[model samples]
Target: MHQARETDIDGAALLAKLNGWARSLGFSQIGVADVDLASAEPGLMAWLERGFHGQMHYMAAHGLKRARPAELVPGTVRVITARMDYLPHTAPAGWQQIEFDRLARPLDATVSLYARGRDYHKVLRARLQKLADRLAEEIGPFGHRAFTDSAPVLEVELASRSGLGWRGKHTLLLSREAGSSFFLGEIYVDVPLPLTESTPAHCGSCRACIDVCPTQAIVGEYRLDARRCISYLTIEHDGPIPLALRASMGNRIYGCDDCQLTCPWNKYAKRAVLPDFDVRSVFDAPTLLALWGWSEADFLRHTEGSAIRRIGFERWQRNLAVALGNALRATGDADIAQALQGRRDSATALVREHIEWALAQRPQAC
Candidate 1:
């Protein structure tokens, strides 16, 4: 609850300057939201009650405070929400089809587009602090904190409330100008800036995102069962991945983008303003076998400074094992089977179990 000196501030003028600063800082859009978020609490409670958060206990640990910003960050009276487009600058036209084509090639490994570059957590958080710094310089020092998917904040709720965009059926913030291919970050400030209006949802009758999910993780409109999501299975969930969902994971070794790939709004998706999101050449078109060949050290060295590194080597190997197993099932390639067999003897118990399951997926073995 750091206090700020009492002073008259021009809210609109400050916002205009803020927008300019945000654009220069690589943010696509900026909006301010009031601290009152009581109306969003029920949905938050219901989502947690259904265990939709999967193993993310932190989502529930904060209780209703996530919906109440002031409580989470004492003295916070306004939230400055930001959107930064992450679509790679080099993505070709019809990129969605390119991603869909990658899924068909089980031999090639796939990492989510947003994660193939520098970790957004690092990129956005630093820039957010910079944004806050500029604000302090504009006025006097003020109470402020920056968050970029690093807290219990209801990010999409605040972003939508601040006129950034609406929550599409896939439960992601969507802008008519930027679609859903962007990263969200927030700056919680004590300054009482003018609140922005919420945008109307524009999902219409489209169900492409729901239909395109390989695991049917989206149970219904705007509802996701994290346990069944490939991104969650590969990155968040630890221990054994549910046996039923392994084959559905395909070659996605990190996060999945099927929903965003199929969304019509993504036709308007914008390219990243900063090169921070450009795809690394190593991950540009890597194969499942190539990634599997990496030791823990290799994984660490190659994925340094990237989001994929956060999953740790065990999960990296575990996820690659599943994709290799699926590849074995699809092509029955002796190389794929041999690769799985090579790792079986040396893998950790968790990875060993997955390797055994993969070996069992061979058509003749079946």
Candidate 2:
């Protein structure tokens, strides 16, 4: 617990100092938001009702508490929303074109670029706490809580209202200058900081993102059916992927970036200012057979600080199997054939089933 000075600090001056601290901490922008997320409640309930959240039962378990920030974090009067650009410094100059080209291959495994390095949850949460600690130094003792995609809260709505960026049609916060390739974090505090005006949506008649989605997960403007979303299928959903959308998933082994790649604003996507987001070697254009060779220990060691670890080794194999199946169908390579054959006896039934599926796609000559 930290305390704030009893002698009230000038709100504007305090905000300026907070921004400076946030920038130093690698946050691209910081905005204060009021807790009145009343408008989002209906959409939240509807999304849950549709079972769009998939196996993430926690989304429904939290109920309306997600809309009530004060309920989740007591004494929270204002929410400090922060954005950190995550496009890796090593990302190619025409990264969007490269990503789209990779997707076109349908056989090349495409892990979302964001997950190819360290887990953003750990990175952003640590920095958000640092920002909170810095605020404590300025204002003395104050009740505050920090969150980075920890759920039980509507982060994007909070961020949009706080002027971080407008919610694009893809339901991701998009900026004319920054695009949608960033991570968001929040600090719920007792202090009532000045709120910033919301940015208006600039996505007029453009529907490139909607048209480009292979799964048709973006049901409409600002609405996503997570059940059909590859990110949810690969990362959030625990069971086997829905049969209907499996082939449509292409070679997205971990997460999907088609929506973000198709967004025109992403042309301006900036490289990460911090080295924390640099792409790791394991994720640097590895072949499906190469990644499928990792043992459980190898998987844990390689992804120790990465978001991919959360999917666990079994799911990791399952996803890789799907991508390998696609690769096998595309290239008819003997290595992919041998790799699928090698994994058929995997201990996990889920992994075995996926391996069997991959083996089924093998050409008759094999």
Candidate 3:
């Protein structure tokens, strides 16, 4: 563990420097939190016990270490949490309505807005490390590790406790000003920085997010049943999507954003100041037929620096096949039928099965 030199670096001044650096890196806000996450352990364990995490075995693999930041990163005394807004600058004025309308168009694929650009893991992780490096330069060497959503860190809990925002009824950290259209990152460091005051919850009786979930994934207030979440079914789960939830998936080929789109607070969500989150051409309002035409090489090249690449080409085709199936049922398009026919002999059984399902939806005339 690297230790900082014993010097007179004002902790308050260091925090101010951090905020300035974070803002320059396109981060909306930065907050510092202590290592005590004892209160979050019960909720974490309960969610795991309920099998709400679905196929994300890694969530439970870390055990209690996720709640104990100091244990995850030895010598860590405080965590610096940062938020980066991802709504594209080019997004239309009535983006929420536009997104909802896209969902209704069963023939058009609806990839999550945040994933339409460069992968956030790369964008946030690099910027966070730079923030830590700047802090080290000011205070002399320091023990630190940067983490985005890559680890088992209780990021929203830490962010809320660190005064970033209050947890909304959906259990996401929400700010009256920024809403929840953002990504979170953290720097676990061995410094006792001044903690920020937590903001009060303001969800009131609103349940817009809860009512809009396609799979009713939000089983109750603040509790998400990952097994039924479209995002989980399409991206995380490697097996066939449960038969019960397939039709409700609509045209969501990558991830589901209905909950966030329905949240009233999102009306205040700001566009990204950085170009890293701008929507890529391939993902912006693409038709199911257009995406289904992509070869594996095309998929890899197009998703080169994007988060969608993590699922690989097979899963990518499998998901698109499901969306294509739904589109075939909705549009009765000959192109969709031809596309499904083209992939019926896919190399992977998973892709082949989804392709077969898609072909079954073809209009008899096609």
Tell how far residue 186 is off in model 1, in angstroms: 0.3
Which tens-of-lDDT digit does each residue in 1-366 have in candidate 2? 233213366888988999999999999999999998888999999999998888889999999999999888776778999999999998878898888787777446688989988899999999999999999888776888999998797999999999988999999999888999999999998887888889999999999989988899999988899989999999988888776777787788899999899899999888888887888988877666778889999999999999999999989888888888777876778888787887787548888777777778777775
For model 2 the local lDDT of residue 330 reads 69
Candidate 3 or 1, higher TM-score: 1
Off by over 4 Å in 1: 4-6
Question: Which candidate leads the pack in lDDT?
Answer: 1
- What digit string (tens of lDDT, one per residue) describes model 3 on residues 1-366? 454224466777877888999999889999999889998899999999999998899999998899999899888888999999999999988899999999999888899999999999999999999998888787767889999999989999999999888887777889888889999999998877778778888899999989988999988998989999988888899998776787788889999988889888999998999999999999987988888888889999999999999998888888888888888888898888887887787548988888888778777765
Instruction: List model 1 lDDT by residue over 248-302, tens digit each.
Output: 9999999999999999989999999899999999889999999999988999998
What lDDT score belongs to each candidate, Candidate 1 first?
0.92, 0.87, 0.88
Clashing pairs in 1: none
Please report how far candidate 2 places residue 87 from its true position, in Å.
Answer: 0.4
**How many pairs of residues collide in each model?**
0, 8, 0
Best by TM-score: 1
Model 3 ranges with Cα > 4 A deviation:
2-8, 362-366
RMSD of each: 1.1, 1.9, 1.7
